[model samples]
Target: MNDFYSVTAQPSRPMGGRRGVFRPGHVQLPVSGVTPNVETHVAIAGDWHSSGYWARQALKMLQEQAPGVRTLLHLGDFNLTANVPWSAYRRNVVEAMTASGLERIFVTPGNHDDWGQLGPRFQAHPNEPYRLPKTQTIAFLPRGYRFTVGGRTFLSLGGAASPDQGKRIEGKDWWRTEEPAEADAARALAGGSADVMLTHEAISGGSRLVDDVIARPNHRLFDERGLDASRRSRAIVTDVWTQLSPARLFHGHMHVRAEGHHSAGRSVYSLAANNSPGNIGVLDLRDLTWAWLD
Candidate 1:
């Protein structure tokens, strides 16, 4: 059990409301407990990147390590690149999860997951199934989506700017929509508070230990893109936290395990990359207690 450092989110300033604002789709799924008197376990992981091999291995490990897990929550970066077609990515992920005997999965999209590019693809391929069985999985949550399981509410907002975009081609590997719009953020906050918050990027305001783990060297090609991107992400997460005031937050992007806390007893857990062995966050829905299975 690792100790977490506590920090407090500053109060959010009031912003004027926008009329006729577009809101992302809200999804709610129902999950049943397998047995009575047993705590429903939810397994959380990060950055699977659609690697069939990795997904297979990771899910198998999860089953072995946390056999009681009833649901799976992914914190994003599920695909290798935005260049890959959404159909291919979806197929790969579904097949892998099915093979691993994982039925229920909820995911928030990361930068590499092509956060914003799926709209047109869905329109173009009208017959292609984009969503899985709601009872089995909620494949993708764009932004401002919330789902409930075992009497606990989880809000998920997914998107992150890619510092490595400089090395990739536009439309093929990079997308401008990797970050959420201001309106999207506002809409997410308007949904009110949640018991647990899930996102692709960790909040910027954390203890020095967290800062140290998230800091990355600047790339010559992208200059300060990494730093700038992180700052932007931090601002968004900060706003979300200040407004929603969730008791617990889980995110994935840095690909390292770290934990932090807020003055109000809000715990923040950043998970390790899902492709790695033994990287899973186990949550006890009965009491909201969580820990790393690794």
Candidate 2:
């Protein structure tokens, strides 16, 4: 395991990003605080699907677009395929992030992601954020994970149902752990509320785009069981949204950019996949304002 993390183990912090103290162990999922600022901003990224090339491009663009931003809240689909070069991916991503002036890219896993690799890590540290075992530069946010920055609270619940399971082989490219369990929702609901919610699956009935996607007609290619599971997963997301009531909710998986808002401050946005327009966004943590960087 002579990866980048191993090589940089000397004097490296136990975690990748700036670590902070949290509420006493009595509180569940207590969030650690970031260095607050008057205008703290972070990059909101869409699905990378585990493409190291896209990973590099996104970081480079972040440097070009938002040079001062040091964090990324990726909305899942960071798939890790067997074909990917884990070491090179780690090295290049770390280099690109450094060049881009980024601190850490927090990922919420998607349906296509290799959950088999992440499961044990999440189990080991279910109460807090943990560095992705092999590539410690990146952090994986467990379901119902919460954190705060610039006075705004953010919640990350990552996992989705793969409607195209017919095309993906289980244990190889697809995993049963893709869908969110009922307990995940309960854990997130227990957090009470958030100013922002980041998810991989669109919340059911939350956005017109999401509703239309679920109601579309030409999904004959997907199996009924997969569709049923997807509905259930979206229901879980919807339940969380209704319970937590985040002012802003953003997600990936539809790979289409569209947004719907009920009031001035409350909205649901869907981002397209990486390498496409609307894949990148800039969020002002101070006021919870959003700007599309593409």
Candidate 3:
């Protein structure tokens, strides 16, 4: 891959009509890809784990190797946003990414994004506490937007809370749920209208790693309620995935590249981030292929 953020736009395609504010650097239509441009490349990475070295190195590699990359995806866990005293390092990584001049930066917030210290804005409170680029639209965050990329509808769910967990944190009276946003996103995809769904947490069978290890100590969504809360989380998450269908899914959180192929249906690639060991996972957008940085 060449070190350039260039993709011959494919002819435009039919995108889901749902509209919201778009982030800067985000282009929803394939003014060119509507024709299905061949050999287009997009970059995917996740789980920074708050390590600046990983972010710096990942950006360097893209600058050198994937210069033609059309998109830069920082999947999630870019930093332990809750623990860091100040977000200088986090800002540095993102700003460095923008400096790369990739057309857009599509990100999903991870549990660590909460910065437990910052309060609910980290949890998608309409208040918008995080420092988003003045140019970007925080997806699914209160009033974020959705757009298509490379023949696929990339539905970015705002940082969300597990319904059960929200009830616990906000108390039953305060728990306001949208019946589960993943299902809503999935249904839009199932309509065969969208190509891919992007979110911070894995929905039901969306990703192998999230399904198998979400409970691990290292996995952010593991319920603070412990083993006993297992029922609550699954009941809320699984129902949504079951009701909706999605062609492909990508996620970060476990910080490992786990490839999932299901006889049940579509294939999903769970990506890890730059801070995890060797670097982050990178996917070839043309054929939906992916490989982890060794």
Candidate 4:
């Protein structure tokens, strides 16, 4: 296939940034003795239905195609409806990751993670704090987080706000507040020299922003509110890009596989959703290769 995607992390002139090991706990027993300079393979997927069928399939594919992968990440949108049982879905995800022999698995929240209505009953559990390691602060925010794997760093950003949520916040808006969160995140990434950015929603500015792509359906939240979610989501995205300018930004939500290079005067990979077999995202590290199973 002519549509192959691969990007490598090249060390920029060493700027003397603090280095730290990832200590986040995983459902699959504790991991000890992580070596530096070791290549890490990671599998990322998101926007799963509440039934967890897609998550299960993605893990199965990872096991078969990217065996020996050290970590897996689910960006968000794990439930089909907010009313679905998270314990059941989490159990499914953890079981699959452990069965695949992955060292760790990380997850971020999506709009559907909310407790009522179309959202899932997802609150930060003591067992799972919805947090990941950062090169800077140890404090974790529910909005977003970061982690490193395969000798590269990844920043995961949350999605846009819905109209209902907006009304509750009064004058608060998603694009405005989310921009700061994303900007601060980018500063952290820049400070850490992060190599990649991952989010549940696509970044609309750079190559991730597609032409003629209807970011939201007519009757959906975006349409009813006149907010192009994909474009609005980009406010945070471009903010990060303007700062860290990571080598890649992998995202899910469109449910279609997309690949494009951003002309941000630098190489920034914009990866689309890998929600299907044909549209999977493939990344080849020096030692280990991972395919983002849809």
Candidate 5:
């Protein structure tokens, strides 16, 4: 098993000054032995919930804890509400990345991010690729979208069925499109194999490490019980895993930290929200080994 260490560290500069609510201090994990041959040091995080405070803190933590990271991948649920202004979301995310010294950021939309409000802003134009604002070095990936970086092929599939949909105001807080369509799953599997796969929901048959971690007292919010919705969501993710057979699969939305190997030989990891300490997952593409970082 890999050992973990926490050391006091500071950012290259002050992060957003003291006003920044999420101030990170004294947490660092060395990647010396784990990443020797790794072509990419990707930092994975999830469920920011649009809290600028946590976003700043999480990015700062990632910078200080895992240096030399090449890409920042946010699994999903980036905003608190789907109705948040696109411009505001863009600005906050850009500032955080700038402070963290990140040049490239890729995001997938979670249920909270898919509220009907974001559909028009992120909808793809005919024949043109969907992309986020250029001012911010961020790109939003649609379900089944695939891209490559650092010689690793990564596929992105985003969406989840919200258990609390009944409580949310239709068109403003919840959207039917929050779940993946059959076509989206088909498109995701069209590509032969992926070095890495990213989603907001976990596959069906992985070890119950994630469920076990989140089912603890006071953590019941992570567990939802709509059988039909659960099955649909799991089916899509399971199908994708079976088809692409990625070497590593990463997901968020459960808001817990856990890792386990799937039956298909893929290593699956679930990350906690940015608001929680030690919520980052660092993956070394060279060997597909990973560890949690604050």
Candidate 6:
């Protein structure tokens, strides 16, 4: 299938996404079936493993791709902000973004991040999104955190299963808190339908492109226990998905750019990894129109 969508041509078919919820580039709305013409836009980013150089490059790309973008919604894999080197680079995250003409960057914590520090912060501000340093331009969106931007409401849930779980040390590199808990799903469901959903783990029931990427042999984990745990993490997202039913869901982790619309008119866009093509996209939240560069 063509990954590129034409501004003039029509979205031809249903690509079969997320059991029954999301779809591809050409989205079909639930009520009007026509895409809106809203102006509020945000830079949508994929995972940034933990490189200061890549971080700056990603921001530079965002500035060029969607100039004047005031905010950036990073899908996950921002890395260990609580640790050294990582912390040093993070302190510069806001400065780089501000130079790129962006105001803020919010992360949905990814598996590669240091949840040892983030988990406690979540407990302290369980109901809201809080700045990482209260003075930094970076903020963490707690699980089940809901907010509105550009007249559209959003739900942010960050966490994913690391295929390399058995390859990393706990408390030092990998934190057990990187996976979403049952409580997180419960809280996310007790809210109104979201106009847009941002998550670190892609919902796994189905989505041809996403499923195909997930099935790749390179991503397989020999750690059966870790694989099982990964499935459990996905289950939580799926369960929350069935209830909230957001019109659009954007996620990263698969590290492949994939889009497919659900039969019900909603859609899903899985972003690529940092330093890769399709790693970033510019989304106009008002109308849900987005464009990503190669």
lDDT of 2 by residue, 1-294 (tens): 112111111121212243333211111112233332222566888887667788888888778777777668889887654457766766777788878867667887788777887767677766666565555557778898887654567888998998888777888877888899998998899889888999999887667876887788346678877888888999999899987678999999988888888765688989889788888888865456688876
Best by TM-score: 2
Question: Each candidate's TM vs. the true structure?
Answer: 0.76, 0.83, 0.62, 0.63, 0.76, 0.82
Report the C-alpha lDDT of model 3 over 1-294, residue by residue, as the tens digit. Answer: 111122344332111232323222224421222222322446677667667666677777776666555456666555433345436775666566666644445555554454343334534443232435443422212212345444445555433343235334543211233222544344433444334555555555656566776545533434454333343333543444354445666666445677677665666666765545434545554445655554
Q: Give a tens-digit lDDT track for model 1, residues 1-294.
A: 011111122211111221222222222432333222222557888887666566666677666666555468888887634444655656666675666556567777777775445545433542232344433354666577766665577888877777667687666656777676675687678779898998887777654555775565446655476568767866887689778889988888777777887787888887778556435767866567786765
Query: For residues 177-237, could you state the per-residue lDDT of candidate 5 as single tens digits?
Result: 7777687788788877988899987676554876664334232332344335645886898
The ten-residue window of minimal lDDT in model 1 covers 1-10
Weakest ten-residue segment in model 2 by summed lDDT: 1-10
Determine the C-alpha RMSD for candidate 5 after optimal superposition of all C-alphas. 10.8
Clashing residue pairs for model 5: 8-26, 49-80, 278-294
> Over the stretch 35-100, how does candidate 4's per-residue lDDT look in tens digits?
222333456655665556665676677677766555555555554223577667666656765676
lDDT for predicted candidate 2 compared with the true structure: 0.74
Residue pair clashes in candidate 1: 49-78, 50-78
lDDT of 3 at 113: 52
Say which candidate scores most in lDDT.
Answer: 2
- Tens-place lDDT digits, model 6, residues 1-294: 122111222222211121222222221111122232222566788887776777788888766656646667889888866355766677567667767866667788788777887889788878655556644456778898876555567888899888678888888877788999999998888886888889999887446888876566354454776777778898898788778888888899888888878867888889989778888888765468678855
